[model samples]
Target: MFSLIYGFYKHMVQKDEYCVLILGLDNAGKTTYLEAAKTKLTNNYNSIHPSKITTTVGLNIGKVDVAGIRLNFWDLGGQNELQSLWDKYYEESHAIIYIIDSSDRERMDESKEIFDKMIASENLRGIPLLVLANKQDIPECMGVREVKPIFNKNSHLIGKRDCMVMPVSALTGDGVDEGIRWLVDCIKRNSYLRPPRNQEEM
Candidate 1:
């Protein structure tokens, strides 16, 4: 009876935790997206303005609980100089959220180059990937369909991974929740893809 009670207590205390990395080029709205997600999930109405968000020099971390799962987001800086630091988190991340500035058409090619390099890293193999074409509120921003071709070119790079791209407006809180929901569902469905856990729980 003691053993059974201990097991039940352990089960009750175990939590579903996931680490998600948010990556994109500088000025792609990564920070805004992270803030928006936290606000939406926690119902923090006093959160700072998404438009007033500045470039992230290092990292902005946030936590949200959805459907009993705790998601820890790591929003890394996207400046040219900061790109080198992205791979440091790849090994520990269960999934990735790559944001793009849809209105910055001139940098689309550059973003694709960086994204290709990122997915090519062996550390990211089999990890679920969610790409957000952010800033959809901009009148001249590119839609998901328009940006799909750029990322879909090297299918072999992500042959073992699941990748999806969607349009969102981080500043306006559009599609952020749906994107996170899809990511969480993907993580739950692919149990093998999850990071290692303690053997006692397994």
Candidate 2:
């Protein structure tokens, strides 16, 4: 029954598609990152009111075709009340992108807790995760070295989960290409899931 729901979810997404789940804390710039990428690619963007940014309740789905890949990008709202929705698609996701504000030193512990939730979720185990240490252009931003320690602390439990962290400045388009390319490469490498068992035949 779950597989059936997953198949329907895939079909509803897009034909010949790859789905990516983008997660982060509130004010982590998840929406801006997606919109900025779209603007950079198309050279045009429709501005959304700042008030709308505050309430991205539930999820915002974006469809983009990059290098022949039909990508279904899901931007999940970080509000506490909306977090339960994240579990519905965790098993269906091809990869997970966890974004964090590199300049927010005060929120590092909270960030770690959210990441821990993602890692602890059974549906996400063994799946590839790409961490975006964003806001690198800000003066107060933490350097990549500073971020390394946090990542190292959580590295042990990530079995078969190929994770990578890259500094990104979504506001200025810095390091965005590397992040997107990493996701595309992960999908192209067939890293979604292992094959199913054939117990009857065995």
Candidate 3:
């Protein structure tokens, strides 16, 4: 009886772990968003000052527990050369968080181009996508309204999957909570199709 009771307790304590990808163009605030998320979701995590956070040449990884689920984020470098390495992690990922620097109007088209290409991949099909319009705190940043139409134009590519485009300021932590909550709910609902691993993300 003791052994059985212990097993039940273990089952209760072990969380379903999901791997998520954080992708976007360089300087689009992918790492900042990841840091902001860690700071907010995990207790006592000190976020790096934005000025001190340099461009990610390789990858940045972060793990946080939210709503009893463990989300392992593999934040790949967004530089053009590094993007080629993104596919290496996709098969293991349960979701994708594509960050966009809404403030960079000059590169909005380029960002959209990459987003479309990434979404068009067969490996990422049926996966939930959370598109975050980062750097919304900047007064000159493009509004979410402007950002939506760009992606929405390719709605056919986004077909039938759980997806959202949300405005966020990773620096200020605004919209992070709502975005994460939405993502968690989407992941749970889609687990039947792509079940989360019992072990931590590799």
In candidate 2, the residue pairs with backbone N, CA or C atoms under 3 Å apart (3 or more residues apart, or in different chains) clash, namely: none
For model 3, residues 17-130, the per-residue Cα lDDT tens digits are 999999999999999999989988999888788778888879899999999999999999999899888888888899999999999999999999999999998888899999
Q: What is the lDDT, from 0 to 100, of the residue 119 in candidate 3?
A: 90
lDDT by residue for model 2 (22-103), tens: 8988788888777666655543567554345655777888766676566678999987777778889888887888889999
**Model 1 agreement with the true structure over 85-201: per-residue lDDT tens digits:** 999999888899999999999999999999999999999889999999999999988999999888889999978777999999999999999999999888777657665343235
Question: Model 3 off-target regions past 4 Å?
Answer: 200-202
Candidate 2 or 3, higher lDDT? 3
Clashing pairs in 1: none
Model 2 lDDT, full chain set: 0.76
TM-score of each candidate? 0.90, 0.81, 0.95
TM-score of 3: 0.95
The predicted structure with the larger TM-score, 1 or 2, is 1
Q: Which prediction has the highest TM-score against the true structure?
A: 3
Best by lDDT: 3
Ranking by TM-score: 3, 1, 2
Off by over 4 Å in 1: 1-10, 196-202
